[model samples]
Target: MDWFTIKNIDAIDSPALVIYKDRVIENIQLLKGMVEGKVEQLRPHVKTNKIAEVCSMMLDGGITKFKCATIAEAEMLAMIKAPDVLLSYQPVGPKAKRLAALVEKYPATKFSTVIDNIHAAEYLSQVFSEKKLFINLFIDLNTGMNRTGIIPEHATQLFEAVQLLPSIKIIGLHAYDGQIRDTDLTLRKHNVDKAFSKVLILAATIEALSKEPLTIVAGGSPTFPVYADRKEVECSPGTFIFWDWGYKQTMPDEPFNYAALVITRVISIVDEHTITTDLGHKSVAAENPFPRVHFLNAPEATPISQSEEHLVAKVPDASLFKTGDVLYGVPVHICPTVALYERAIVIENNTAVQEWKVIARDRKITV
Candidate 1:
């Protein structure tokens, strides 16, 4: 089987992360078209591409609102001077203090976070109150994805309790429908409508009781398209920045292209049919099973095993590939895989142009 090789594969170090800038720009444009030019309705999550350059690219495309999963990600957005930012993850202990400090430091940027319980809200209020500051918050609604959100029934109570805290202002509701992964667009929309119906009801009830306007940020990569057109919902899709193999196969309807790839080299030939590459668990996300990476050149190759620094795959004819030959692979899960790398080589016009630092990969930022 023939494999696609990079133009300057010999120049790049082995197991390097590659980002196609032109494709990323194309993706941004496609998403913009998906939302019908209403860029404000798209609050892309920065957890996918943690690079500030990507954030700047989004800003250049008229996307200002951003969502992130860590303090460091939020800091990266703030550093970019993004008009609005949401720390999608709930913080505790020093993280909470650090969040308030982040808000204090970036006064020009609007900062918000998600909360499911009163304790987190109260703690954040106390932390911000000590600093004579306030932070915006959205109540995370558990719409079937029982990860980090309050159930719809308890949202009203949480909203009321949060209002009492002077330092934290209730902005809206956040519902992450990550579990809505039906490949069929119709079935996917059905699941999204059913799950988001609860969010809508809860939002209406909270708004009626509080007599305040509220924005709803709902859905992840899968359900973003379903909610993008809704008048009351702001879609926060992360993986759209760099489409991966998993979503490409699962959601074939999504027009986004793969903007990221892993460039690895064959290190050893185990036998006539078996070979090992430098791409490994540390290079790509191992959370998924074998075939974590889809080889663009050798589509028939089957991944057998993966270690910290190597991936073993059995090909129809391993002799076709020699040691030191570069291979391009699209990761099954690009988000976590991105966090594993410290930097990515930015490719433009099929040539390496620059490097983008994955600054937000770290868990903390010195605010």
Candidate 2:
């Protein structure tokens, strides 16, 4: 039987997310092997797979540190008693208070966040100080992503200024070179090195002044291999947990497999060359243009248009397909696609065993 083929397909409804339990475990092992079995140097991000069970699998694999993008994701990791969690986002406004409350609620889990400017740093300090809580922070450096981070040239000055803050302490440096995704491994490495050189210089300057070494957390799935070889850096790659079609086609060097899939069924035959399925924009990640999802069973069917509840596809012969024919599909982007479903059916030994709630998909979870 195929890896995704379920013997009891009749029990599962259409337009449902499914996870292969064995493949997930294997992906965790593959991630560990990439770092030479040193789980200490790894801080896998939880934003990709927001399920608590998947985080528990990483915990079982001896991974203690984690990185998240939201308060809900951080709370999910703390609920599982993850040893350490770094909120990779810059918490501002009421988010600062929410993070402070989360820290007080889960004392067992060490919580930290990233900061790129003095304004955010001062705001976070004020919020944490009012509650008599001390928070750790990593200097978010803009290593060419042009996203949310301080430029390397100005990072040291901000670092020195933030050192005077009372309630927050600078603990590390975070450089997310997400834009350096060259298919050629050599070219990718060179670009990563070029971007990271400034960060290394900043780290050295900060350590010289503070009289301590700064912990470095860097990279995502595409840039993980470049940072894995560095002993001083903690690599954070979230998508390795559930590989998607985008990475598989772009980065063939990484060998992670597709561990999750969306199951859909043919709902109607539009014409001799066209058909519609239950998988629609709401069922998959539609951020990309056409072909948001690739159907494994019906490879020839091309998704031309999608609506809220229907995805119209052009096929060679619609007469060959009838209603209720199950089609297994791999989403082009699995992170947002997983958020569309509240629960995922767990598959074990080709049988539907149980459902795992996508608890962290919510904006808030008991913070």
Candidate 3:
């Protein structure tokens, strides 16, 4: 479907987020093919779309397990009656209490979280104990991404400690290889395999000590394909559903399509070589460098400056464009970009069908 030729473009407001329903379904099918039709092995992170509409699409496509970074996202999944949901973030203080309440409120969905330290686990245990609940958990192992996970060497010790806790259940290990971005398939595979080897060993040790099976959830969009075929590991790739220009340029060999776009309009014609659009930092994610989005119709355009409400771009021939002309752009980072908008315009058959609320955009939802 040519989203650029959507007949209802002029009616919708500028700088609006648009999601192509058909493209999203196609992307889900591609992901299923990657995992050999094993939807249970795919726990897609809902932090990418953050909308129940997309979650329903995933459910319709037979994807049951899901992952999210915030409680709000998990609540959305629970509201939609997702059978399995993993809160892939460490809950601390009140957030820990909130996680317990959320699990209690949504009894139909199985909820879990990740932790790298004992303090957080102890706090979660205390909160869950008060509510008489048991929360499943995965040890967040820092394979190489010095982010929010425990070191590989400490995984066994942390698992042993958590196993004794009364309120939290030690499910398995979570190793997010977000640092591996090599487009070369061989190099990427080597790095991913090296990281997985550490977690696999830890998984074996934990299984031996606990005398039970362990489920390893690993990898993101970049390293998903590398570990999808691993029978023991369940892949949680969020960006595969709504791919962006960032992955397209970095992992050129991947067959995922762009399912979302930021629709902006030319608000002003600065000069013969320049024009300004309504897209700005508030409209799209600005964490990346310049050219935060790729214009599909104007590839020669280079973003010069971006303010809160405008994005000035220098084009090869500004005469070809005029004020009020609609421009569709693919965000470089689709995850955060989706959070910048309150809702998305659902497109199908070159027409706007509905608006899906960005339900989990906020950090908290009164569970």
Candidate 4:
């Protein structure tokens, strides 16, 4: 698989993001090794690459348990009726109400949702009860993200609320602790270890009082190395399959073969100091200082800035490329940038071989 490299994505089309399947599998296998086949569960996050083929590969690699960020992704997977699928995001308001309806239809499927607010918990309790659904309820503990989840201390209260509901069975605790850490290696390690330690305490507390043992779900793409070996529950980390520039540098040795590369054509060689390509922010997420450029015969170049349909990059020896030359860009944010395209043109050595559908991709989720 490593012998086959993506040929030339630019020759195929523009405004396209390409995925190399073999490399992706290599990436998954690399991460899988880090877990040492020791973790009780391994649920790969589907947000990074929503294509069923990629999910199938992860499933093949002893990751039957899968996590998704959207109700739509879960609903789509439920349509296929995939086993052990957990909606990792907090399901609040009417959306979960609509989503809860899905559970009754597929009782064989194991579906889980995260709860942080008692109101949301109470809402789910009623919704699941009304639907006659048996849901594996999880307490979303905010280890470090500070965006969602109840505090670690409040997890027990949320667990108690599930008991009150009766329909929602307390099953797990989830926290994606990677986002809070900075680029610093030691800081990332300390933050990830601290977050998981808190989750460990919550899990122990739940077990001490409740008859049912609680499963802990932690780790993200960046911090999986820290939490993967932990004795706690399972691991679900996205972006590891196709790591971005930010993550590639951070985890240099980790497997990142499955990453996507956007192939762009050099449209305007504005000057010696600046070169322009067909792709821009609309095609790739330019969150980093610049986009990483990977031309076939040349070294990597960085996009200085982007416009609606054009990318202005800083490149040396721009004389080789005319207006018709091609360039490939590795996006900064793998998750969000993957969302920018409708479908991924999967390639092997510059030839378009397969098409992967990006399922359940909704930008605006109305709560």
Candidate 5:
């Protein structure tokens, strides 16, 4: 009768992803509640759950806008007829053209992307202009993540230059404060406010020049609570859909349940203190060190090493386990772990009901 227990799990193959249908719905509700039922401000990123059916569930719950990292995720949202989709990544070269094609194909859905530099913006302008199309853009700000974004000090100049591009329109600012994930809520907010002060100044400067209010999209799961109270900003939290062990440990304040897991079985008995499972590097997110996956059934089984096909673990007593014994595990990182599987077995009321294809996991889906 446990929440993650599947009575008919024997039908599911080993090293497969499984989603609890009801828990996913609960997580969506929790996300909406954080914004006080303001679904308009909830532009969730679909990178965690790439399945079309999962996105539809968010749509059914009155979420219209979405954020994605790739063109395929955008197309998947469009396929579900999502009202608005933002490709958070800056597209250059062929990516810009493929995005333009997606826009033309899904006329009903409004698509936007982020730009950090004028070169990328002008290139996108050329690509969209050739197709006789216009695209909306958000100025990407680097809020200490040092990833792919322009610093706030020099962003005004870049924003002004991008304004001259005819094929692209400046919609707003996109600042991902992904680096502000302190466990203490007060300290986390202070850091977020400190970094976002520059963003606010940049927004004010741009708004004065454009003579229009600018939309601000910001934050991920760890910093979601900090940005949730800001009535004007759109919060993009992806992993809340399928809560993982990483965030669950790091962001203890956010009370999202673990809704997805990898079900694997013991393949061999290595020694009295060691055993191996089918959950390997190919089955889960192996970027982190040992304990990449925590076995829900056998919490003491510590992962010692992982290869492409198997994960060796140090258990208290291997005699307690046998071949074909199933072990439900929660991955430390679920986003990339999800991309490893093509489908997820949907569990409803402790029974495996159906399979939901991880369609958007592919790089190209008829873009």
Candidate 6:
């Protein structure tokens, strides 16, 4: 099957996730400029773009700190040997324990993790021994969202437990705006203010007890700027790394930096308002109810209503496509969606270019 191979991408496999390297660097530059001399420096989450090429782009923008979700991701960065890396997601299972052991293999790497509960802390601390690995302790504050953090009031108890473990150090807090969830600009601002105020209080308490106070590492793309402007917290914005429908509400203008896109060929023409494409649940993440096309000028093209094998797009503009014509799919949830794919078919100007492996896609559970 022939796919549009713009420039050097005429030979890659089909149904691939392609990243415009040039565009990614541009977006990285823009994102960095937003935080220029603002915070301690950016530690962009690598979960957004797992490819080495994208990580290199972030390095080009004076960013050295990286936040990774999986052990595979941390290992990949260790393989790349980037100076600074943080495993953003906690390694909480047998797989995670194996990853923590890898830390001894690479002594020069700076690794940190988050923990709110004692079971998770004890599990990770036991693996990293002899004060050899000092894991950063983040009091995952549940301002409201109860996903994976201790209550703001109970952070000290968790910290004291990790402190006793001898293998860990309570470095800081890993709070984010997802716990707030209020959409009102004023109300959201208020929520962020109160939430962070609690974070600062918690951080200061940790600082009072220890020689090195905790580094408050917290952020979500939606309220990043609010959190970024603060002095105590280090901004870790991943959605801004590759803007998608899931990230559009956060960035009104230049939403999709043209970084990530899915290439799928039109498989059927069901009717006037409906067109079937090969992209489906496996290609896009099911987290967001609706997915939209960045270029279609309408959401119905892929409209978050998606099933497993087929995406029935309500396309009224029938003239723009044919049976074999191709278009890219822009996912609402870029992270899990990208994780679902095996590799990204890197392209430039609509051609199949290079194959970038999703090296850290499956490091789901880290003990």
Segments in model 5 whose C-alpha atoms lie over 4 Å from true places? none
Query: Mind giving the per-residue lDDT tens digits that candidate 4 earns over 1-367?
Result: 2332445444577868888777787887787778786534577788888676777777667666778888767766665557888888877776677667767666666888888877887888788777777677788888767888888887887677668775777788888775644566577777777667878887888998897787888877777666776756587778888877667766654566536877777888787767788887788776666544444444545566778898887777678678867665666677878888888888766577888877656643231
Which residue runs of candidate 2 sit more than 4 Å off their true CA positions?
A: none
lDDT of 2 by residue, 1-367 (tens): 7888999999999899999999999999999999999999999999999999999999999999999999999999999999999999999999999999999999999999999999999999999999999999999999899988999999889999998999999999999999988999899999999998998999999999999989999999999999999889999999999899999988899989999999999999999999999998889999998899998888999999999999999999999999999999999999999999999999999999999999999999997
User: CA lDDT, every prediction?
Assistant: 0.89, 0.95, 0.90, 0.73, 0.94, 0.68
Candidate 1 structure quality by residue, lDDT tens digits, 258-304: 99999888999999899999998889999998889988877877889
Q: Give the per-residue lDDT digits (tens) of candidate 5, residues 216-310.
A: 99999999999999988999999999999999998999989999999999999998999999998899999998889999999999999999999
Scored by Cα lDDT, where does model 3 land? Answer: 0.90
Cα lDDT for residue 168, candidate 4? 77
- Per-residue lDDT of 1-367 in model 6, one digit per residue for the tens? 2232355433543456777666676777776666665525567778877767677666666677877777778877776777777776766766556666667766677877777788887877777764356565566676666676777878877777777886777767887667654555567678788777877777777777776766777776666666655766677778676677655654453333656777666777776666777777787777655544443333446453567877777776755667766666666677777787888876665555567888778653232
- The all-Cα superposition gives candidate 3 an RMSD in Å to the true structure of 1.0
Residue ranges of candidate 1 with Cα displaced over 4 Å? 1-5
Evaluation by TM-score, superior candidate among 1 and 2: 2
Model 4 residue-pair collision total: 10
Q: Which pairs of residues clash in candidate 3, taking residues 3 or more apart in a chain or in different chains? A: none
Summarize candidate 3's per-residue lDDT along 200-223 as a digit string, tens digits.
888888899999998889999999
Looking at candidate 3, the ten consecutive residues that score lowest on lDDT are 1-10
| Candidate with the larger TM-score of 1 and 4 | 1
